[model samples]
Every structure is written in structure tokens, then in C-alpha cells.
Target: MTLVNLATVLSKAKEGKYAVGAFNATDLNTARGIVEAAEQEKSPIILQFAESHSKYISLEQAANMYLDLATRACVPICVHLDHGENFNTIIRAIKLGFTSVMVDASLKPFEENIQNTKEIVKIAQSLGISVEAELGVMNAEDGSGSLDYNTMDDTYTSVQEAKEFVQKTKIDALAIAFGTVHGLYKKEPNLNYERIKAIQNCTDMPLVMHGGSGLSNEEYQQSVANGITKINYYSTMSFEVTNGLRNYLNSNSDAFLFDVDAKTIELVKNNIAEKIQIFGSSNKA
Candidate 1:
């Protein structure tokens, strides 16, 4: 399996040479596309399987499918569990051969988040698995375009809290709140670059940026400069792939639509390859 340790990849990023791509995957095509794009770029990549993905969809089957695809490719790859909340699932991911797992206890109180994350680290560490923990909550928004804290606006995280959390939990990577919200941002995100810099200076671990799908180009560049080693992209790539397939079928329906529609794998791969290139990971692998 191509389950290389994330610590190695993070070390590479620490040198400011090549930033590894971390793509969020929901299904087979998306996972394949991520690995294929990494291979094309000759860069290492982290394939993140989010826990919020429709619940209890056996990781063994998924990891095997994606891991096999990754190993045979020409680049280093890692399987990661994103936003893993439950202990059972985190353990399952480790048992299923995921090299890294994110334990998001951001919504919990400080001490509780620490305990929760520490428990995960303790278990995963013994099993040769890496852990990623989140310090702040990213509020969820609705389709009606409103700040829904009750439903889910923003919860900022402190740089000091981040460092302490990491020290107490011993996680390999830390995802902090720097003003960017999760999912597709409806407005221009006012990312706190200052906070990011502070967190980076405080903690030596690689930083992960959630809600990367809709950030402006300048914001992304700034984030990378400020210490965003891994960016979690889900919404944008998913939309791009789905839209590409739809457009291909509709535009070519009269001619090669049927034949081309059958080529789902290539379509998804090309769609994701476009994203990998745009994210500046094309040749960094």
C-alpha cells in the first residue's frame, strides 16, 4: 500500500520546497483522480476520507481500493481520515491501514478537546498512525445566505490555544481557525493571516487549512506563505468534476455524448487534474 507516513511529507513541506496536496475524497472516482493527479505531478499527496461522508461506509474496502491505486502510481501517497470524531471510527481507520487520521474536537471545550484528541493520539500512535487535530470550529452556513451560528457564523481560535493543544495532544498536524469557514464560502473570506503566522511561529507542526475551496488566489498564496502546508479541498473539486461530466454529456449529447459519458474515470481524472494544476501541485510531486 502507498500509505507513507505524513510526518515525512510534512518534513518536506517544512523546507519550503514542495507543498503536498491533500484532496478530500467521497467516492472511488474522486479518490482515483487525486492519486492520478499526484502521479502526473510527481508529487506526494494525502487522500483524505472525511468522516462526515455519509456515515459508516467501510474504510477497509475504500482504503484498499484507494491504497492499491496509490501504490502502483509513481509518487508517494498517504491515506488520511478527515474530521474523524468518534473513537471507534478513528480506531477503524487505523486498523484499516490509514496512515493518518484527523481528530476534530474543535467544538468541544478546551480541556475536553485536549482529552479527546489525546486519547486518539495515544491509540493511533501505538499503531503507527499519525493524528491531526482541529482547535477551532468552522461554522456552517445555509443556502439562503445567512450567518447561521444557531444553525452554525464563525468561531475563531487562539494561536496560544493551538500550541497548547498540540503540546498536550501530540498531534502531527493542526487545523486552526484563521477566519476561513468550511465548505464553499459565499463571500470573500477575511482570513486572519496574522493569526496564521502567530500559530505557525508558536507550533512547529505543519498547518492545515480547511475551507480552501473558495478562497481567492491571493488568499491562497498568502496562506501558503504564512504556513498553510496542507489545504483541504472538497467543494470546489467536487463541483468541478460533477459540472464537467454534466457539461460533457449535455454539450455532446447529439454526437458522442453516450460514448463519452461511459468514460467516467477519465472525465473525473481530467477534472481533478485541472484542480491539482491550479492548486500548484502539478509538478511538485
Candidate 2:
């Protein structure tokens, strides 16, 4: 099967009561590992790369690799742009063959965020690409000392606004902050399931949950129960592969960095495969 939109994946996930894993890819090997894991599990997956990650690997390089791999892989795969702020970056992603895109205007005011997101939606629509937009902010709130505290923050989206935005923007999916933060969480995030439910009820679009790394499996399940179909994972997968490779290479300093030995690849692959199973996407292809 070819690359599909976020709607199809999330719709299937909504029926299955599971969240599709959107794994962050930094390099060719990283992308390869993600695709390999999904193939092994027979799970459909979205290969994600944020705007910041573009500095290291341009959209061209990453997209080429993902497109090639997806064509050869045994399962459905979607290349997704995660947390991109501007249209320039987003247009580049669309041009690079990304099947899905996320415009994170949560840091901006409501009206401006909507305008910019709507513009992106227009462009992506012309390209037949799925667009995901965020409504609220998910900041890094570390400790009591941090002023960024938002434990299940009720700055949550109102049902009225959600309906208007989805209708105005024509976005394929909506990502609400809920309680999950971007980086690691200092405390267990108590997601606003009620808000998710209200948002899901507000419109028929797919619901996306960010900050997938820090939440517990039970929390993730609750999110799925509340209509979360797409779960974005970045730090978790990076940590998993890096941690595994670090532990393996520590015993042997002769490890080649350019072309990782088969043993090291196995460790990384195993870690990713485990996450694919954990996210309940196994056998989902």
C-alpha cells in the first residue's frame, strides 16, 4: 500500500482503541530502523521530523530516504512533519513528499494562529496532504520553581472554538496540549480526558496527543479511550535507540560510527520494535 493520510490511520486507530506511533527520525539509520521495526511488526507508522531537526538533515535527505523505504517496505508508512512553525518549512516538507504535516501555532494568539494555520491548510489541501494543527501551548514546566506550570491546564479548547477552527481551517487532524509537555516531564502528566472527549465530540476529525514520551501506558490508554488516535513520540524513541547503542558500544570501543555493526543495529532495531509493540500498532498493516 502507498502512503496514507492521518485521517485513515487515526480512524482505524479509533476503531482499534490503539494509537499509531509517530517516531522521530534524525538520520538515515534512524529512519531505516523505524521502517524496519514497523515492517517486522506489520504495523503502519508515520516517520516524523521536526523543524529543528531540519538543520541536521534537510527535508530533502530525510524525505528521499523515507519515500524510498516506504515504497519497498511491507507496511503502509507516512512521512510526517512534526512541530513545524512556518510555511516555508512546511512548503518544503510538502515539496519533499511528506504525506502529512503539523503546524504548531500554539505559541501565538488565537486569531493569528488560526490565520497562519488556515493558510497552511489551504496550501496542503492543494497538494492533497493532510494537515494537523495545535490549539493550546505545551511548554516545559519542570519544577515548582518553573513558572510554566500547567498540570492538565484548562486553557483547553472550548467545543465552540474547535468546531469553528476545524471548519475554517479544513485541517485533517487536531492536536491539543492537554497536560503533556514537549520534553521530559517532571511529574506524571494528568491528561484532560474530558477536554479530549469534548473536542472529539465537537468535530469528526482525528485527535492527536503530543508529549508521548513521558506518559505512562495507562495514561496513553486513557488518551485513546478519550479519542486520541495519533500519538507523537520523539524523545522516547531517540533515547531508546541511543541508550541501547551506548550500552552496547561501551564494551567495544572499536565500534564504527559510520557503518554501525550488525550487532549495534540489532540493539536499536529491538528497542524500536518493542515500542511498536507497546504502541499497539503491531499487526496493524
Candidate 3:
């Protein structure tokens, strides 16, 4: 019965000055590990199913698994749809009982992004669901062995535009691009802490950070200090699990499939627990 919407936990995070970890789960084992980590750490967490990953697990199937997990959990769990690209997917997520949804139209023109986000906000809010919208484009790993610092400014979220977008869309959270990208960074990322502070000053709501993996501890804490209240992390967790599986298989050539699943669950749980501690959400449940 601890299932709740995104706004509920994020509001507490804003007040407490600690960001909640919003981790993406592609399957039941990963989702279960995330919840177990939260329970062990006594922290509130967001379990996300991204639209891009719907190919591996359908939206309907993920919803059923996540809902079952959330209902039986001891701590608050927000089952969220991450990076929902279109109105149809967002609507389907709502019908499937997602507590929160993100409408990502950041690739569109400013006004178009606003209009698209607003439409979803209007619908989702009426049902007591929290909506999140992205204002700037996050770079994806292009195998360049480093982020193109030259184009960083071009992609960073404008402070003024953020204020307007929040006002118009009335979203519960905002994902702003301040130099982070999807997948592993080829080199150390030059995060824009100042930009985050400027946007926070204007919007005065929970701000979210995507591509939150592979940052140093200082970077993560600094982002929180600058007002990032939710961080979407995935790549590093996936990498760690893959490495763990490789090592396990190398040593145990006769390992059963159930044994592999058990190892994955253990690895995922430990990795998430470490992140919970870094996010300063431990014991905050």
C-alpha cells in the first residue's frame, strides 16, 4: 500500500534537500533489486519503465509487474514512465496505472514542446498523476570518446525558457540538460552546475537530471545542492550487472539459469544501495 505518485516523494525531497534516485528497470529482476535496495536503505525510490525499452517488455506487462511490486513494498514507490515520447504512449501509461509520466518533446520547437507537454499535463493532472517534461536535448553517446564541449552551450536549458515551460505546462518535475548525456561518458563530463542553479532559481520546483550515471560523487552532490531533486540512472547499473555476470560465468561454467538470476538480483541490489547512499536518500523512508 505504499505506492504513490512522483510529486509526493519529490516534494519531500525538495524540502529535505536530498534527491531521490529514479532508476530505470527493464525487467522484473532489476525492478525487484531496486525495490529491495530502497527497503534495505529505508529510502523512497522511483522505478521507471522507459518507452524505448518497451520492445523487451511491453508496457502492459511492465505495469502489471511494477504495480504488484509497489503495492507490496514497505517504502513509498513511484511507478513512473520515463521518456514517454508521444501522446499515445503517455495516455497508455496512464491507463496502465503509471503514477507519473514524462512527456519528452524537447527535440521539438520551444512552443511545440510546450503545447505538447501542456496537453498531457491537463489530462494527467486531472487523474492525480504527476507529469514531467524535458526542456533541453540531452546528448547521446556518439563514440567520439568525449562529449563535444563546443555544442554543450547549444543544448543547455535556457533559464528563462524553463520558467515559461514550467508555468505553461504545469508539470510536476522538469528534466533539464546541463551537459549530461545518455549512456557512458567517454570522458569526464563538464556538468553545468551554474545552469542548474539559475533554472532552479526561476522555476522553484523539483528539477530532474537524466543520464545521471558515471558522475563523480562530488558532481552528484553538487547537482543536488544546485536543486536537482530527481536523477535518472541506468547505464552504469547495466554495465555493472554485465560485468558481474561475465565474472560469475567465467568461474562457474556449470551455473544454472536460476543461479544467474540470483547473482543478477544481488548485483543490482548492491549497486542501487550504493546509489541510494550517494543520493543521500538512505534512511529517509
Candidate 4:
């Protein structure tokens, strides 16, 4: 059982100049894909469930399922709650044994975001769970995965405010909105490398890059080099699974419908393995 806290793995990534991939898993197959990628590449990975997806899988179920897989795996893994908006859900995740939780009150006012995050930090730190909080709102206001980068130009993370936010909240990681949107970009994204470096200098906490799915390999490397220690990935993997399953259904005979799930898992595993390498986490377990 190699289940460890997010701080342990993320701290190592910070020191090693790499980023750990945090994949959002909506079902057991997606979870297995993430874990398999980490195990195969010898990389530490995080499996998380967003608040919106909790309706499909309960906190207890996610914790139990991932804990089981993590304990038996050779690589280090952490179970985390992604975009944790509701306090009740955050409490439930912690009580259910999640090793990390993100308090995403970015949409709220600055003071309110701080107050809400501080509350969660107090509880999470007491139980040795790492807390990650977002400072700026991304382009994805709706639940839809994609976002318009232009609409988010005015909302990039403020370096000075980030220092204060971290100091007040005592979070383990900070997810900054540095020009990247949540879903696939319709046009090429102009990532603010300068802003990332500025924020990186403001705090020593492991920095995170949201919307990591659509960037080029060079962009990913640059982000990691500039101090991104954790990257949340999902949009591309979700597309891969959906596309794979759809193709399988269209081509395969009725007798082979039952095999679609297995095929989708295989496709997800392949995609994540590539992502782990892109994030420079391969062989870092």
C-alpha cells in the first residue's frame, strides 16, 4: 500500500523540478487508467473527483476505491477532492480519508475566498490533509470544460495578493489562473510565463496549473520549469475515452458491446502515460 499524502509527493516534485499529474476520475475505469499510468511510468499521481461529479460517486466510494488501489500499487498515489466548493462535501471527503482537498472559492469575493479557504485549511491541516486553494477565477465559469482565454485576461492571479492569500490560508498548494482556460482552446493559448514566474517568487508552496489538457509539450515543460508542481488534467482524457468507446460501439458487433469498457480503459491508460511523460513525472515515483 503506497497511499501517501499530497504534500509528500508534491514537495518532492517541487524539489525535483517536475510536476505531478492530478487526473479527475469520474468512474472506476478512469481511476484505474490514472493509477496504471503512474505505476507503469514510475510516477507519483493524484486521483481526484470534482464536486459536480460527486453526484455520480459518493465521497466514501471514491475514498474507498482509490485507497484500495493505492495501497496495493507500487507507486505513490493521493486521493484528492477537486474544485471542492461545498463545505459539507469537503468535510465528508476529509472524514472519508481523502489525503488532499481543494477549496475553490475563487468565484467569491477576495475576503470571502480567503475566509472560506482558511476554514477548510484549519480542518484539513489538523488531520494532516493538504489543502489547495485557487486565487483567481479561470475562464470556465460554467460546468462545460472549455473556456475563452480572452474573457480571462483580466483575471490572472495577482502575485502580491497570492502572497497574502497563502500566508493567511496556510494552504499546501496554490492553483493560479495564469492565462490558461479550463478546456481545450479554440485558438492557441498565450500562457503568461512571466506571471507564473512572478507568482512562483512570491511563495514557496507548490504551485498548480489548472487546464493542463490542451497545451503543447513545450508549454508543459516551460510551466514546470517556471514552478508548476501539480497539473490538473481531464479534458483530453475524457475525450479519448468517449471517442474510443464510441468507435468501438460503431464498429464492433453486438456480441462485443461488453468489451467496450475494457477498450476504453486501455485507451485512457495510453493517453495518461503520454501526459505523465509530458509533465516530466515519468520515473519520478
TM-scores for all candidates?
0.89, 0.91, 0.98, 0.95
- Mind sharing the TM-score for model 4? 0.95
Better of 1 and 3 by TM-score: 3
Q: What are the per-model C-alpha RMSD values against the true structure?
A: 3.0, 2.2, 1.0, 2.0
Error of 3 at 159 (Å): 0.3
Which sections of candidate 4 miss by over 4 Å?
141-151, 254-257
Highest TM-score: give the candidate number: 3
Q: Give the alpha carbon lDDT tens digit for every residue of 1-285 in model 4.
A: 478888999999999999999999877887887888888999999988888887888778888888788888899998899999999999999998889999999999999999999999998999999999999868753445455655665799999999999999999999999988776677778899888888989888899999888789999999999999999999978976798788777787673644766786788899999999999899998
lDDT of 2: 0.80
What are the runs in model 1 whose C-alpha is more than 4 Å off?
A: 55-57, 148-154, 254-263, 278-282
TM-score of 1: 0.89
* Ranking, lDDT, top scorer first: 3, 4, 2, 1
lDDT per residue as tens, model 3, 49-149:
99999889999999999989989999999999999997899999999999999999999999999999999999999999999999988999877766684
Lowest summed lDDT over 10 consecutive residues: which window, candidate 1? 147-156
TM-score of 2: 0.91
Evaluate model 3: give its TM-score: 0.98
Candidate 3 stretches greater than 4 Å from native: none
Predicted candidate 1 versus true structure: per-residue lDDT over 65-151, tens digit per residue:
777776787887888888898888888888878889998878889999999998988988887788888988776545467853233
Which residue runs of candidate 2 sit more than 4 Å off their true CA positions? 141-154, 258-264
